[model samples]
Target: MSTQSQPSQSVLTEEESWELLAGQKIGRLATSVAGEPEIFPVSFEVSGERIFLRTKPGTKLAEVTISPRVAFEADEIGDDAAWSVVVKGRAQVLEREEDLAEARGTGLVSYLEDGKTVWIRITPSDVSGRRLVPGDQR
Candidate 1:
């Protein structure tokens, strides 16, 4: 038996990336604090060209306030293959009433009892994705 070194991966278009984001609910948020990097599982909603998430006042919120730049990623795994999408953008804390109202209309529900109602919007500058396939597919 022989083993292949590289598996096949298909690059997803921008539209496809956005579509995947809209369809997926759970994603990982990449942020940094005091030079250390961290990734947290987040529930997000896609609205137009921005991604919105609700988080309480905590480290994740504080880190983004100082850095602003962040990355959000979501993926799907199958028995034989997997797909991943990433959105690189800046995080902004929404405080205006209008902004909060608009985000509330998106049907965002928080599973935490800590009242994670602070809205954070990530404006994507780059959206990309890839779908991996088994070596046999190549």
Candidate 2:
């Protein structure tokens, strides 16, 4: 007879979640406009407890302005393991000069060719993550 352990899932700590989030440059931003939900792929940077991303005048910006509450998610998957992080909080456009300067200092560049001139900051009220380790199936 042989004994085997099944795959397991674990909840990540807040620090672990932040570490994972900081390592990834791409994430999905979920926003709602009059109860209509939309998600957008964005390139972002983590600074302290805040997340920053650049965007142009578009639906994403418009939605954020309309509904400041949003959600951001990032994840990594591999053959052996996978992890995901979710951040729920309020987002705002960087309007103050000091804030704009700080955001510019993050060196965050948009994947788009041009027009990503607006900086939005996400201040997370809740952050959570999960990690999954796969077991042998064969």
C-alpha-based local distance difference test score of model 1: 0.88
lDDT (10s digit) by residue, model 1, range 1-138:
565556789999999888888888889999987789999888888998789999988889998899999999999988798989999999999999999987888787654547897899999989999999877632
* lDDT agreement with native, every candidate: 0.88, 0.94
Tens-digit lDDT string for candidate 2 (1-138) = 545568899999999999999899999999999889999999999998799999999899999999999999999999999999999999999999999988988888777747788899999999999999987766
Global Cα RMSD, each model: 2.4, 1.6
Best candidate, TM-score: 2
Global local distance difference test of model 2: 0.94
Predicted structure 1, TM vs. truth: 0.89
lDDT of model 2, residue 136: 74
Candidate 1, residue 26: lDDT: 88
Tell me each candidate's TM-score.
0.89, 0.94
